[model samples]
Structure formats: C-alpha cells, structure tokens
Target: MKKSSETAAADRRLSTVARHLITTTTNNEEEENGSFMISSSPTAAAGQSVFSNIVGAPEDPILGVTVAYNKDPSPVKLNLGVGAYRTEEGKPLVLNVVRKAENLLVNDRTRVKEYLPIVGLADFNKLSAKLILGEDSHAIRGNLVTTVQCLSGTGSLRVGAEFLARHYYQHTIYIPNPTWGNHTKIFNLAGLTVKTYRYYDPATRGLNFQGLQEDLGSAPSGAIVLLHACAHNPTGVDPTLEQWEQIRRLIRSKSLLPFFDSAYQGFASGSLDKDAQSVRMFVGDGGECFIAQSYAKNLGLYGERVGALSIVCRAADVASRVESQLKLVIRPMYSNPPIHGASIVATILKDRNLYHEWTLELKAMADRIITMRKQLFDALSARGTPGDWSHILKQIGMFTFTGLNTKQVAFMTKEYHIYMTSDGRISMAGLSSRTVPHLADAMHAAVTTVV
Candidate 1:
C-alpha cells in the first residue's frame, strides 16, 4: 500500500511539470508571433529599422512612358512614346523582305547553326561595310575599315563607346543637346565623361545652327563628337547638305573624332543611297570615323537585334589593330552577335534579286511614314490649331517634335487619352488615316484649352 501511494504522488507531480512546460512554450510562441507582426507592419517595413536602407530607383524615361500607357484603361489611348515604327493600324510590322530572307535561310539545307566568329560573320561584315561605306569606298579598296556585327544600334553604340573609353585618350564624348535619351547614359556607363554641344533651339523649335557651329568649333580637338548621320532622333531635324559639309569641315579642322549613329538609314528618305550620303561623304574624305548602323528601323528587324559597327582608319595596319581591339571589347560584352539576324541580312544582301525587292519594300515603309506626316499636318491645319503645323512635314523619319509643353501633353493624356512623350515628340508611324483627325482634334483641344 505504501509503494502504490508513493508512485501515484510522483505521477501527479510529473504531470504538473509537463503542463507547466507546455504553457511556457505556448507563451513564447505567441511572443514570437507578436514580434514578427510588428516587424512586418507597413510602417515598420518602410522604415530603416525594419528594412534595408537602399532607395528604389526611378523607371527609365522611355520605357516608363510605355508602362504608364499600358496601365491606362482608355480604349482610345495611343502610345507614341517609343521610337518604334508601327503600321497604320497601330500594330508592329515585320517587313515582307525580312520574311523572304528568312525563307531563303530556312531553305539552305547545307547551312549549319554554328558559332560565328568573335567579330561576326565575314560575309555579313563585308556586305554591311560595303552598304554603309559604298561599294567603291577607298577604305574597302585599301582594307582600312574594320567592321564588326553588333546587337543593333544601341549595342553598337555601347560597344563603340567602350572601345573609345579604353583606347581613345580623349575620353570625353560630345553628344548633341536633346540627342537620344540613352546616349548620355551609354557613354557615362562606358567610363567616359559625357558632354553636350548645342543642337536644338527651343525658341525657334529647330536646329540652332550658329550655336552648333560655335560649340563644335570650340570643342577640344581629338574629343569624340557623336553625330546623328541621318534623321536625328526626337526632333527629326537634320542638317542640310551644306550644313553637313560645314560641320564636317569644322570637325576635320578641329581634329575632333566623329562617331555617326545611323539608326534610320533607308527609313529616313526611302532611298538607301540618299540616306547614306552623309556617312559616305565623311568616309570618302579620309576622315577617321566610327559608324553604327541598325537594321531595326530599315529592315523592321527590331526583335532580331541586327546591326554593325565600322571603324575607318588611315592605314590597313591601324585597321587590323583596331579590329583586334574591337574583338576584345566584344568578347566580354556579348561574346558574339546573334546568328539568325546576321544570316537574314547576309542572305538578302548576297542575292541581287532579294536586295532589289528589299529596297522597294523599304521605300514603301518610308513612303507610308511620309504620307502620315502630310496627313497629320493637313489635319492640324484644317482644325486651325493656332500654330504653324508645317514643321510636321518638314521633319523626317518616324517622329515629329510637336512643340507641346508638358502641361499640354498631360492634358492630352488626361482628357483625350492620347499618349506621347512629355517632350512633345509623337511617333508619326503610330498615326493612321482613321486616327489622324482624332489626334488632331485632341491636339487642338489641348493647345487651346491649356492656354
């Protein structure tokens, strides 16, 4: 009886200790949950005490416009923020020439999907150089031009910038005022100081010729000056032939290095030869220059990302050295350019018939954009929008600087669902016959209502 009684007391004591332990654990868990809840609270999360101290970065100006446009629920919203060319129906277009080229590439059973050389395909580079520098270019005859395939215009620009940053002693690159939004970033990232020369004048809403001449004239000799070879971006205001000659002379006299960004070659005037005149003239003059050419706008190969960069030099020895250095720069950047786009371009350029067909198709696209410009101008004039609308037709390429202030642009977005850059540039390619009148009306309202 004594043993059984002792056992029962011990069991009761053990059970009491077990219940105390369970209650302590439960209390600790609840405390942990409360602490976590406090840490994760909205106020706490936003505070430095709870989260890391890194600040969020702002969205890209060009791409951010697209993001805002996408979120807009209005059915009438038009996205004129980007530089991409669109059909009259406001849809992205793939050129018929590109399709034909692709078909030819597919039919070539012997062609292998092999790695391209570090610089890119030999034939593609040769053909690309010929296309930009002309068939009888002295640089080609003398073998003084080093060409490399790149990831479209932007990529080509980046690669060229990097090469300059590494090799060129004068690391300062002078870009035009109100140039491509990304030019400054590209050069800065490439480890060069970015400077600007006068190009645009707000008072006249056109090129400031005197300011430009003075800026270039005063720029430090040997400094790199980036030139829009044809169809200047954002403004669409290009220097006339005479202006180009004077600019070229000044650049040569100042010993400034010229870097031509030829993004809209054939797309600008619908004639490849006409569009290539500036680049050809510079090269023909024995001026050491860099040319970055994109097939995106001209061939409608945006997604394919095809482009080339050619560096013209005074001698074959220098050209060879430059080519080697360019290969080194390209090695780490992307290793090599894509094969498909290069192949398509090569196939088209190699065949005479395909090349002729491609030119016609290019002309058609350019002609359509020209037509849109006239239509938009006519619509604006008919509506008597309280301003001279002739600049719409005067400007070339896919865009027109509408000279609308930020408030007017905002008004258009809020009241009429018409989207455009805050800088007042509109993508003429985005306007169709059906939408031109509507866009003109919206512009008229914004212009008159705001003031």
Candidate 2:
C-alpha cells in the first residue's frame, strides 16, 4: 500500500511538472506575440483560447480555393485556383532537365553542403542578373547593377520593399488594381503604403491603358510603380510593346521609380528575351529600377523557391552600397537562401546544353498553357455559352480572367465542384482537354439559369 501510494505521488509530480512547463511556454509565447501554442491542462486550454483569438483573421482568398477543393470528395472536382502548372493529365510536372540537374548535383563528389553567402551563391546571382537584364546589358557590363539571390519572387519582392521602405525617398507604392492578391500585403507588411492604379477594364476585358496612364501620371514624383514584366496575373492583360515603351517614357519623365516583378519570364511567351524587353527598356535608358525575378514558373522549381532581386544604380559604387544595404535587410529575415535550388539553377544556366534543354522544356509548358486556353475557348463556343468567350484566347500566361461574378463562381463551385477564386480568375495551366467540357457546361448552366 505504501509502494502504491509512492507511485501515485510520482505520477502527480510528473503531471504537475508538465503543467508548469506548458504554462511557462504559453506565458513566453504570449509575451512575444507568437502565433502558435499547446495546452496540457484545462487551465492551459483556457489560456490557449485567449491566444487563439486569431479566429478573426480572414481566410486567404487565393489559398482558400485549394482548401475547399481538397475537402470535396467529388472525383470530377477541378481546382483552377492557384497559378501552379499541371500536365494535360492534371498532374504537377517536374521537368526532365530538372531531374538531370539533380542527378548531376547528387553525383558530384566535389560538391559540399556548405551554407551560401548572405547574398546567396555568386554564380546564381550573376546568371540570374544576366537572364533578366540580358547578357549584353550595359549596366551589367558597367558593374552598375547588383543582384542577390532570394526566396522566389515573393521573398525577393518583400526584401526589396523593406529596403525601399527604409531607404527610398518615397514610401508610397502604386500597384495594379487587381494584381496578385499578395502584392498589397507584402508591401504593407514591409511598412510601405500601398495604392492601386487602374489596370483592367471590365468592359473590354482588357488593359485599361488610358486609366493606367492617368493614374501613373498623377502619382507623386519618385513614387514607386510596380510593373509585371510580362504575363500580368489574374487578368492576364499585358500592355503591348508599344504601350510598354510609352509607360517607360512616362515613368522616366515623371522621375517615378520602376519596380518590375518578372515572375513568368520564359513561361509567359516561351522566349526569355521577348519577355524581358520591358525591363530592358528601362535599363537601357540608364535609369534606376528594381527587379524581382523568379524561376518557379520557368524552371519548374516552384517548391525549390529560387529567385533573385536586382537593382540598377548610376554607378558601381552606388550599386555596391545598395547590395550591402540589401544584406542588412535580409540578415534578420533569412540569413541566406538555400543552396540546392541555387546550385541547380547555376548548373543549368552555366552549361550550354542544359540551358538549351531548359528553354525547350519551358516553351513546352508555355505551349501547353496556350493549348489549354484554345481548348477552353473552343469548348465554351461549342456549348454556345452566353457572352463573348474570346477573352480566354486573348489572355496570356497561366491565367484567364473569366470575368465570372462571385455568385456565378459560387454556383459553379456548389453545383459542379469546379473550384476557382471568387474573382473569376482561373489558372489556365490547371485545365485539361478532359476537364474543359465540364467547366464549359458549368459556365453555360450558370449563365443561362442564374439571374
């Protein structure tokens, strides 16, 4: 009986220690405003409830589509929400070249798992700058441009925004009215003011060039303007080359800063040079601009998160200082980028055969997305779906702004299990010939039956 009593006492002691640990951790987390916690007792659960007041946080509109799609058990369910590329069979793709690159990397006896520099792999940074700025770029040749490897396009953008917010003379940033949803959030969280410039025209289902020009013209001198280098997201409406030249003139004339977000690159038009023309124009004019370039779409390195940020300055000395400051901005956030992805990119880009193969594979992906666009448009036409579906073909890159209202999107989701963002933006890469008919039928039904 005494031994049993001692065992019970030990159990009580352990429970008491666990409870104390939980309380102490919870207290520390609360003091730091940490977003995560665990509870071990009823009292701890009560404390967790207070911390869980994050219930008020709104769902991410873009990611929420995937969440709802996953919960649906319907086999016919379609997810055209996020801008991820998929094969015609609706499966994610990892390019053959990427596989070969990985094979080379894994087999290399000389390679080590050393940490990259704070600015990232030097070879990756140099190649990335040349890829976006062109091999013959004068600024690059003059050593007036600084490039740093970053965590894909979003991370590059956030790092650039934070630096601009702290050092740039202007804090106000003007973005497209319906840009990628995260643009505003990224800039705002970086402590910059976000403003919208009119971009899409609902009437024509195209670029509101006049409205865009007016908005940028009215922006304060030296204000930062975000430009999608190619393949504008959500709407997929990009200004023509002539329009880009005009925009460049206006921005330069007004002394406004240009910040290019080149996420699509070769994935948009199947030619890296063609996609980079807009950015090159500003660089050619010997003007200062910021560029965030991503390989997620082009290299099929989505999860690998490889990208870079480049800043053009008037002199090499200024470029050096800009890069030093960028390191300061990145130090506390993420000390350095991952080595594997950067190594893969550098391996491909530095080699002639692998680089050629990469371009071919990139073109194939772009061609597939283009094919999906044509198939979707044809299906809609065959079904005699109401309204002009020409916009599907007119749009470029991985998305088509279907212009479907929120109610129609809801109806399609409810009745057809075809999931897309409420804003009617659909990832064209997500569609296949097999699924086009289902989407077409849903559109036809929604348009005809819904008021």
Candidate 3:
C-alpha cells in the first residue's frame, strides 16, 4: 500500500510540472509579439490561410494558351498556340528512330541509373559538339569547343546566359526585337541587361535588315547579340545566305559576340546541314560564339528534355577553364542532367544508320508542315481572306506569323473556337489538312467582322 501511494504521488508531481510548463508557454506566447507559430494551435481559426494577402499572378502568355484551350468545351476548338509537332491526324509524333533508340536502351541490361557528372554525358557532349559544329570543325579538332548537356533549348539558353552574366565582361545581351517570348525573361533574370535589335517588319512580313544592321552596328563592342541560327520563330522569317553573310561580316567587324539559338535547325530546308548554314558560317570565321541546340523537334524527345550548349573558344585552355566555371554554375542549378535522354541521343547520333533514318523522319515532318502551309494558303484564297496570306509559305519551321492583331485573335477564339497567341503567331506543325478549312473560315470571319 505504501509503494502504491508513492507511485500516485509521482504521477501527481508530473502532472503539476506539465501544467506549469503549459502555463509558462502560453504566457510567453501572449507576451512575445514574434512568438513562434504552431500551426495546430487552438487559437488558429479553422481553414484560415496564412497567405491571404498574396495575390494570384496572371498566367504566362505562351503556356497559358494551352490552359485556356483545354478549358474550352467546344468540339471544334483548335490550339495552334503551342510550338509542337502534330501528325496529319493531329497527334503528337514520336520519331521512328527515337522509338528504335528507346527500345535499344530499354533492352540493354547493362544500362544503369548512374548520376552524370556536372558536365553531363561525355558521348552526348562530344556528339552534340560534332552535330552542331560538323565533324571537321577546327574548334573541336583543336579542342577549343566546350560542350555541356543541358535541359533542352531553353535550359541551354538559361545556362549560357547565367555563365555569361557571371564571367563575360558585357552584361548586356541584345536579343532580336521580336524574338522568342522566353528570351528576354531568361537573359534578364540571369542579371544581363536585355536589349533589342530590330528583326521583323510586320509591313513587309519579312526581316527588317536595315534596322537590324543599324541596331547591331550601334551596339557596344563585345556586347552579346542573340541570333536565331535557323527557322526564326513566330514570323518564320530567315535571312537569305547572302544576308547572313553580310550580317556576319557586320557583326565580326563590330566585334559583337554572337549567341545562336538553334531550336528548329532541321525544320527550315528539311536538311540539317543546309539549315545549320547560318551558324556554321559564324563558326567558320574562327571567332568565339555560343550555340544552344535542342533535340525536342528533330529527335522528337520533347519529354526527355535533351539539348546542348556549345561554346567555341579561341584556345583549348580557355575552353577547359570555361567548362570548369560552367560546372560551378550548373552544380547549384540542377546538379546534373538526366542520363536517359542523353543516352537515347547518343544511341541515335553514334550510329550512321539511325542518324540517316532520323534525318528522313525529320524531313517528313517538315514536308507535312509544308503541305499544311499550302493548304491553309489555298483555303484562305478560296475564302478571299482580306490580306496577303502569301507570307504563310515564306515563313519556315513550326510557326508562322499570321499578321493577325490581338482583337482578331480574340475574335477567332470567341466565334470559331480557334486559339493562337495574341501576337498572331500560329504553329504550322499544329495544322493538318482536315483542320485547315476551319482555320481558314475563322480567319475570314475574324478579318471580315472584327473591324
């Protein structure tokens, strides 16, 4: 009985201590204005949010297009706002070679999930360098090119920009005035002062060569100039070989640095070599430049997010040093890229048969876009659409600048359930023969009624 009484006394003492601690904590919380918040405190009102004052942000202009498209219940709704390839039946395509490469990778039992070095896959880097700069490129032969696997075209661009902002003397990057929607945001957030050089002329539906030359000529020497190596986006306007040569000479003479974004290399002429002529021209001059390449379109590895950023330097040592610094920049961002995508790319690029097959497939996609372009043009002609729709054929790659204004685009969306960017850009690859007629009708109606 004495032992039991002792245990009861101990329990009472513990209970008293616990009550005292609770009272002390409550007093401290009441007295301290910056008291630590316990989310489950009884004082907290049920279902109340701590972020009540934070406002919702508007959706991104490009990505939001699809979000809006998905919400529309209309059966006839068409989404031409995104820059992705669709088949003649309006399905996303997976290249035959990509499937073959993936099959080989899957069957290889020896393939292990190993973390790539911060620089990424060695074979992918080397093959990517060769793919962009050519097999006989003196830069690669001389070991003056540093290549790193990046997260598709946009990631390559962002990595390159961050590197330049930290290392290069010039913090200003002059992008084409009407360049890709993400270019300005990418460069600016990397701490580079974003500027613009005139590129597109809406009036002629062509390049503003004189304006571009004037802007680049006046830019400070050593300032970086962004170039769409081939298949310029939105407008689909590309400078002819002669114009590219003149632009190259002007840039080199002015000592301006060129940074090429080659997202749609094989889409322009349906030939990789021919499409890369603009970038090859710049590299051929034996000057330093940056090239970011994406395999999303060509390899149809959109989900894989495989791409490369290649820096052509003056000497081997400089390239090595640049690579080391690039690693420092990347280590904090993503640590390293995934191996599956790089492995698939290496499998296809290393084998000659697969490479040839890939080119043929790429050509087929391009040809389909060409057919759609012609059909759309004919459809517009049949409707007698108000403007010169000839620009449809002139613009290359996945996108065509339709010259439709914001109000017209809204009209198209409201009345016809056809969706595209407010800037009047439509994805040529998103079109098919079956859908061209509806698009033509929408355009005719938008132009006729939305005055």
Q: Which runs in model 1 stand beyond 4 Å of their true positions?
A: 1-53
Residue range 1-451, candidate 3, lDDT tens digits: 4444324434543443343334323332221211122223333456876655433444567778999999999999999998899998889998889889999999999988989999899999999998888889899999999999999999999999878866777777898868787887677656667788999998999999999999999999999999999889877999999999999999999889999999987888799888888988999999999999999988888889999999999999999999998998899899999999999999999999999999999999999999999999999999898889999988888898999988999999999998898889999889898999999999999888886
Report the poorest 10 consecutive residues by lDDT, candidate 2: 28-37
TM-score of 3: 0.89
Candidate 2: stretches off by over 4 Å:
1-52
Number of clashing pairs, model 3? 0
C-alpha TM-scores of all predictions: 0.88, 0.89, 0.89
Compared with the true structure, what per-residue lDDT tens digits does model 1 show for residues 1-451? 4444224434543443343334333232222211111122334454456445333334566677788899999888888888788887889988787888899889989999888999998999999999998889999999999999999999999889878866776878889988877887677656667788999887777899999999998899899999998889889999999999999999999999999999998988998888989998899899799999999988888889999999999999999999998988899777988899999999889999989999998898889889999998888888888988878888888789999998999999898888887789898888888888889999999889996
For candidate 2, what is the TM-score?
0.89
Per-residue lDDT for 1-451 in model 2, tens only? 4444224434543443444345434342222221223443344464466544332333467888899999999999999998899998999999989999999999999999888889999999999999999999999999999999999999999889878876776878999988888887677656567788999999999999999999999999999999999999989999999999999999999999999999999877999899999999999999999999998988889999999999999999999999998998888888999999999999999999999999999999999899988898888889888899899999989899999998999999999999998889999899998898999999999889875
Q: Which residue pairs clash within candidate 3?
A: none
What are the lDDT scores of the predictions, listed in order? 0.84, 0.88, 0.86
The true-versus-predicted C-alpha distance at residue 25 of model 1, in Å, is 49
Error of 1 at 55 (Å): 3.0
lDDT of 1 at 388: 80
